[model samples]
Target: MLYREDKKGNRISALGFGCMRLPQDDREKCGRLIDSALKSGINYFDTAFMYSGNEELVGSLLGRYDRGSYFLASKIPPALCFTKKDFERIFRIQLKRLGTDYIDYYLIHCLSDYSAWNRLCRMGIEDWIREKIESGAIRNIGFSYHGGTADFKKLIDSFDWDFAQVQYNYMDEFNQAGREGVEYAHSKGIPLIVMEPLRGGSLTGKLPQKALERLAADNQSAASLGLRWVLDKKEILCVLSGMNTEEQLSENTAIAESAAAGCLGEDEKERIEFIKSAIRESFVIGCTGCGYCQPCPNGVAIPACFEARNNFENGKNHPVFKMNPARRQYLHSTAVLGKSPMNASLCVKCGRCEKKCPQGLKIMSLLEETAEVMEPAWFMIPIKAYRMINSGKKR
Candidate 1:
C-alpha cells in the first residue's frame, strides 16, 4: 500500500481502516477483515470514544499484534468533557477499553469550531495534552472537525496540532471543511486524515443512473472512483473508509496499492466532473447525515428524514409501480422500530437545528417538505397505531 508522512515523519498507511462501522453482530468476519487489513500493510487504525464499543472491539482484535507495528488512532469526545478531571477520566477509560497504554494518534472528537476548541482551552486542555505527550501516553494530538472552512482555519491556528481529520470527498469538495480547509491545514504543515471519502456511502450505492453509466464506460466501480479521487491529492495523509464487507475491503486495498498524487489523467478528471453533475441533478437534499442537527426538541429525526427523502427521490429512474424502499426505511427508522415517533411530521419549526448545521441548509423548511412527501396518511396511521399500542403496554 502507499504511504504518507505525518508532521512527525511517521510513515502512515494512505488507507487507514475506520473502525466506527465495524460489523457488530459478526465478530469472526470483523476479525478476519481486520486481520486482512493488517496483513495487507494498512498500519493506521482509527476509532473514537463515542463510536459505541469500537475501542474495545479494536483492542481485542489488534491486541495480538505488536503495538509498535501499527499506529492506533482514537478520539476523546469534547462534548463529554466539562472539566479538567473529565478529560483525565475519559482518557483513562479509553486506555482501558483499548488495552493500550499509549494512543499513537489521539484527537478531540467532532470539534465544531474555534469557540468549541476555545472552551476546551479554558478547561486546561493544552496543559493536559502537554503532560500526556511528555509522559509518552499520547503520541500525536489533533481534532476531527465538522464546521465551516473559515472556522476550520481559526481552529488550526488555535492549537499546536499534529494533524486534523475532516469529512472530505469528491462530493464534499466544497462542503464542510472542504478543499480550502485541506489546503490551509497543509500550508501550516498539519497532515490531514480524511473521513467519509465516499460521503457515508452516498457516492457509492446511491449514485444516480447517469453517474453509474459514466463509471461503467471507464470500467470503474463507484467505490474505487471515489477513493482514488481523494487519495490522488498529495496533501492528504490518509483516507479512512469504514469498510464493512469483503468486497469493499478488497476493492479499496487494490486502489490504495497503485494510487499516487496526480494519478488521475485528464480523461478521468472529466469523467468525475460528469458524475458530479449527474449527482447534483438527481440529489434532492444535500444532507451528509453528520447528525450535527440531532436531538431535536420536538423529536424530529432530522438526518434520517432527509436521507429517506433523498433515497426516494433518487429512485425516480426505477420502475413507476415499484414501492420505493426509502418509504419503508423512513417508517422503520423514524417510528415503527424506534421507542417513539421521530418522523419529519414532528418538526415544530423551532429553527434550532438550522443554527447547528454545518452545511447551512434551510433545515426547518426542508423538514416541512419531508413531512409533506414522507408522511402520507397510510404511513402515519400505522405509526400512530404502534405508538398507541406501545404506550398502552407501558401503562
Candidate 2:
C-alpha cells in the first residue's frame, strides 16, 4: 500500500478504511474484513460517535492487533457539543468505545457554519484540544466540513488544525470546499483527507452507452475510475472507502498500491469528463446525499428521498446496488439511518433545506419528484407490509 508522510514522519496509509457501513448482520465477517484490511497494510481506521455501533465494532475488531501498529481516528459531532465538560465526556466515551487509551486522529464532525465554530471557541475548545494533545490523548486535531468555500476558508484560517476532511470527487470539483478549498489547504501544507470521493456511490452509477464503452476499452469499472480520479491528485492524503466486502477491500488496496499523483493521462481525463457529462445528462434531481439538508423542520427525509430516487433512476444496472434498489434502500434509511421515517410525502414546502444545501437543489420540488417516482402504491405496499410485520414481531 502507498503511504503519505506527516510532519511527525508517521507513514499514514493512502487508503483508509471507513467503518460507518460495516455489515450489520455478521459481526464475525466484518471482524475478518477488518483483520484482512490491517494485514493488507491499511492502518488508518475511521469511525464516529454518531455511527451507531461502529466505534464499538472497530474497537473489538482492532483491539486484537497491537496498538502501536495501526492508527485510530474518531469524530465528535457538533450537535451534541456545548461545553468543556461535554467534550470531556464524549472523548472519554469514545476512548472506551474504541478500547484505546489515545486517539491517533480526532476531528470535530461536520462543521457547517461560523456560528458553530464560535460556539466551540466560547466553550474554550481550542484550549481543551491542546490539553488533550498535551496529555497524549489526541495525537492530531482537525475537522470535517460540509459548508461552502468562503466559510471553509474562514474555518481554515480560524484555528491551528492538523488536517481537514471534506467531500471531494470528480463531480464535486466545484462543489463544497470544491477546488478552491483543496488548493488553499494544499498551499498551507495541510493534509486533506477525502470522503465521499464517489459522491456517496452516485459516481459509480449506470453510464451512457458511449461512456461505458470508452471506460471498458481500458478495462475499467465506474467505481475504480471514480476512485482513481481522486487518487490522481497530490493534495489528497487519504481516500476513505467504506468497504463492506472482501472483494472491495482487495480491489481498493490494489488501486492504492499502484496509484500516484497525476496518473490519469489526457485520454483518461477526457473519459472522466465524458462520464461526468453522461451522469449529469441523466440526472433528474441533483443531490449528493451529504445530509446537510437533514433534520428537516417538518421531519422530512430529504437526502434519503433523493437517494432512493437517484438510485432507482441510475443504480438498477450497477451490480452492487441492483438488489431491490430503491425501496430496500428507502426502507433501510427510514428504519435505521436517521432519527425518523419522514418520507418524501411529508414535505410542507418550507424551503429551509434548499438554502442550507451547498448544491442549491430545489429540495421541496425534488421531494415532490421523489414522491412521484419512489412512493407509488405498488412500491409502498410491500414496504408497508414488511414494516408492519417487523414492528409487530418486535412488539
Candidate 3:
C-alpha cells in the first residue's frame, strides 16, 4: 500500500478502514475483517461518536492490537458542545468509547457553517484543542466539513487545521466543499481525507445503461473505477469508504494496495469527465450554491432546500440520508418555523432571490415547483404524524 507524509512527516496509509460501517450480527466476523484489513497493511481506522455504536464496536475489535501499530481517528460532535464542560465531557466519552488513551487524529464533526465555528471559538475550543495536543491526547486537530466552499476556507483560515475531510466524487466535483476547497486546503499543507468517495454507493450499482456500457468497454469494475478516480488526486491523503460487507472491504483493500500516486491514464481521465458531465445534465435544478443569492428575506434556506430535494430524488437509497433519522425530523420541524420562512409554498413571488442568484435559477418559480413536488398533502400527513409521535415522546 502507498503511504503519504503529513505536514509533520508522519507516514499514514493511503487507505484508511472507516469503522462507521463495520459488519454486524457477528462479533467474530467483525474481528476477522479487522484482522484481515490490518494484515493487508491498513493502519488508519476512522470512527465517530455518533456512528451508531461504531466506536465501541471498533474498540472491542481492535483494542487488543498493539497500540503503536495502528492510527485511530475519531471525532466529537460540535452540536453537543454548548459549554466548555460539554466539550470536555464529549472528548472524554469518545476516548472511553474507543478504549484508547489518545486519539491519533481528532476532528470537529460535521462543521457545516460559520456559526458552528464561531460557537466553538466563543467557547474557547482552540485553547482546549491546544491543551489536548500539548498533553498528547490528540496528535492532530481537523474538521469534517459539509458546508459551502467559502465557509470551508473561512474555517481553514480561522484556525491551524491539521487536516480536513470533505465529501468528494466524480459526480460532485463542484458540490459542497468541492474541488476548489480541497485544493485550497492542500495548498495550506492540510491533508485532505475524502469521504463518500462513491457518493454513498450511488456511482457503483444501477448506473444508466448508457453509462454502464461506457464503463464496461474499459473492462473495469465500477467500484475500482470510482475509487481510482478519487485516488488519482495526489492532494487526497486518504479516501474513507464505509464498507459493510467483506467483499466490499476486500475489493477496496486490493484496489488500495495496487493504487499508484497520480496513476490515471488520459483515457480514464476523459471517461470520468464525460461521466460527470452526464450526471450534472440529469439534475433538475442547477444550483451551484455560490451564495450570491443569500440573505433570503423570508429566512428560507433556499439553496439547502433545493439541494435536499435534489438528493431526495437522486439519492433515495443513499445510506447517509437513511441512517440519520433525525434529519427527517429536523426537516419536518423546520418546515413550520415561520409564515414565510417555513415551507417552499410560502415563497411570496418575491424576485429578490432570483435577482441575486449567480446561476439565475428563477428561484421564485422553482420554489413553487419544489413545493408541489415534495410537500404535497399526502406527504404532510405522515410528516405531521411523525412529529406528533416524536413530540409526545419528548414530553
Candidate 4:
C-alpha cells in the first residue's frame, strides 16, 4: 500500500506483488485477489519469463484494468537467448504474453558475472534494449541479480540502470550483494528492488522462544518483522513478496504502509541479530525451495534433493545420515512425485540450474555433496523399504 520512487521519478509500491507463483488454477479467485491488492494501493507488479505461466496469467487478470493504473515488470533470460534474434524474439513474445505494448520495467534476468554480461553485449543485447526503450516496447532498463558482491557492484556501476533487484534479507546481509551493494547502488543514484525479503519464507517461520520474545515487544508476526526489516532501509524502492492468499496480501500491504527506515530501535535490531544468529547456527543448506532452478534437462529432482539434504543436516532428529528425515522424504519425492527414484548421483554437473537460482548456490557441488551422503549403496535397501512402508501408510 505504501509507495516509493525509483531514480527516474517513478512511484512504485513499497510492497510490490511478486507474480512468480499466482495460483495456476482458480484464476477467477486470483483475479479477485489481484483486484483487492490494486484497490489497496499496490501498483508495482513483477513477473518473469522463467516463471512459467505467471506472465500470461498476469496479462489475463490485469486486462480488465487500465494499463496505466499499475507498473508492469518482467525479465529477459540471457541463458535462453542464443542470438540477437533470440533476444528480441522473447521481448516481443513477452509483450504479447502480457498483452502490453510496453513493459514499465524490463530486466536482464538472473545475471551473475562479467563474462555473461559481456556475452550479452556481444549478442547485441545492450543495443537491442535501447531499441526497445526508444520504440517504447520496454521502459526503465535494469537487471535482477544472483552473484558475488564484487560482481554485483561491477554490474551496478557498469550500466546507467534505472534500478536493480537483488536477493537481500537480514539473514543474507553479507551473502549476496549484502549491505555494501545497497550503499554502492545508492551512491550511483540507483534505487534497489529487494527480492526474497523474507528469505523465501524462512524468516516467516517460528524462531526460538527467546527470539520470539524479542520480536513480541513489537507485536508483529515474524513475517511482518522480516518484511519490515527490508522495508526499513531507505535506499530500497520496493521489496517483492509472492503472496498466494488474500490474508497474506492484506498483511503484507499493511506492513508496507507502516514500515519506515530506522523504525526498529536498537533493542529490536539486536533482537533480530540474536534470531539471525540462531538461524546461522542451524547447519542447513541454504536453499529457499523456490523451484526456480527446476525441470532439470536431465530430469534431476534438484530442489527436492537440496531440501532432503538440508533437512538431514538441520532437523533435530537427523543428526546423522542414517537417521536423517531427508532420507525418507528424498525417496518420497522421486518415488511418489518424481518419475523415478532419482537422487544426486544422476547429476551430470550441468550448470543450467545454477544460472536460474536466485540464491547463487553452487548447485552441482551441492548435488555431489548430497549424493555422497544419501546415495551409499549399503543404505539403498533400507531407504527403499522405508519408502514402501510410507506408501503402505497412505493406503
The model with the greatest TM-score is 1
Clashing pairs counted in every model: 0, 0, 0, 0
Per-candidate TM equals 0.93, 0.86, 0.74, 0.88
User: Which regions of candidate 1 deviate over 4 angstroms?
Assistant: 316-323, 336-339, 378-395
TM-score of 1: 0.93
Please rank every candidate by TM-score, starting with the best: 1, 4, 2, 3
lDDT per residue as tens, model 1, 249-298: 88899999988888877887888899899999998888878787888998
Question: Candidate 2, residue 355: CA error in Å?
Answer: 6.5
- What are the candidates' C-alpha RMSDs? 2.5, 4.9, 8.3, 4.1
Model 3, global lDDT? 0.77
> Which candidate model has the greater lDDT, 2 or 3?
2
Write candidate 4's Cα lDDT for 171-216 as tens digits: 8888878899888998999999999988777777635455566667
The pairs that clash in candidate 2 are: none
Model 4 gets an lDDT of 0.82
User: Model 2 over residues 196-230: C-alpha lDDT tens digits?
Assistant: 88887677654556667777787887777878888
Worst 10 residues of 3 by lDDT: 321-330
Window of ten residues with lowest summed lDDT in model 1: 386-395
Error of 4 at 278 (Å): 0.7
Ranking 1 against 3 by lDDT, winner: 1
